[model samples]
Target: MSGTTWAAIDLHHHVVPREYAKALSKLGVTEGLGVQLPKWEASKALDVMDAHGIARSVVSISAPGVYFPAKDPTSAVAKQLSRAMNEACAALVRDHPGRFGVFATLPVPDVDAALEELRYAFDELH
Candidate 1:
């Protein structure tokens, strides 16, 4: 490997935007995948990043993602969740300067919504 040093980049960092967390709580998703959702805040995340010497973190919604009520075939809720999540992440990046980046959530399995989000994310959110 080329010996080089650059500030660390955390590629798979998860960010629970405030509204998203509230939405999840309302949905009764206290825990899943054998783990309760931990509290997260921008200040707390920055602290963790500093402790780990991470110069930047690319944030996105983690597992279980924006989808909800597995029975819904229309994926209507997922689209809304993805939009809010992406907007929040974009706001963080805009406000925090160099501390964070975004992966841009998409309402997946929904081709039309995903395409719209992809276009909006790159063209507008960035």
Candidate 2:
């Protein structure tokens, strides 16, 4: 090892943008099913990296990140929310290059929709 001191990459981080926050911020937000986020200040995330000597992070979406109010969890609305969340995440990483990476979200219980989202995230978004 060259003994270079750089911040380690944290592969798991969440930023509940308006898209993910919207569902969680519903009329009756509660525990268990409620949307939750750490004190997701970007500065704070970076601060941890600085304190821990980590230079980068590869972020991922945790479970129950975003929910759909529709009857079917595999509804188009869910897909839309997923897409929006992905977009926002991409933007965040783009805005802060060399510091963050994306861990995309897909409206699960919907395979086709997830595939489409993958295409969009990798292809169109790229």
Candidate 3:
């Protein structure tokens, strides 16, 4: 299974810094139970890939895709979450090389943050 190949991009994942995840946890989102969905770890993601024979995964922001405001108290927290998560994504790609890719998660609903993140992600990261 590990040797087998399939294109994949588990972009809609979350393995952010603990504090950030906890803050998100406080927001409390779930399908039905109302329990906060636990953060998704990169190792768990990779392990799943190993099990499923997925060759690679492009990690990116899922829904809530940074609709969080970039101002307020939560704004900094949101920005930190966004930055930390994106950095984590990059690190995952770095660790896995060709097996992984990452898309920047901007603190959005904020056009300024989106454009800023875009410039940074494309210009600097590229």
RMSD of each: 2.3, 2.8, 4.7
Q: How many clashing pairs in candidate 1?
A: 0
**Clash-forming residue pairs, model 2:** 7-53, 7-54, 7-55, 8-54, 8-55
Task: Look at candidate 1 and give me any clashing residue pairs.
Answer: none
Candidate 2 per-residue lDDT over residues 1-126, each given as its tens digit: 598755466777656554555565562443233444433567777777878878788776554555554544447666877788788778878887888888777767677888898899898666
- Residue 124 lDDT (model 2): 66
lDDT string for model 3 (15-124, tens) is 44444455555565332234344566767877888887777776665444434443344566556666666666666777778877777878765667777777777686
lDDT of each: 0.84, 0.68, 0.62
TM-score list, all predictions = 0.89, 0.78, 0.67
Clashes of each: 0, 5, 2
- Estimate the overall C-alpha local distance difference test score of candidate 1: 0.84
TM-score of 1: 0.89
Error of 2 at 32 (Å): 5.3
The digit string of per-residue lDDT tens for model 1 on 1-126 reads 599777899999997676887877776776546677767799999999999899999998766677775644688878888888989999999889998999989988888999999999999897
For model 3, the local distance difference test gives 0.62
lDDT for 99 in candidate 3 is 76
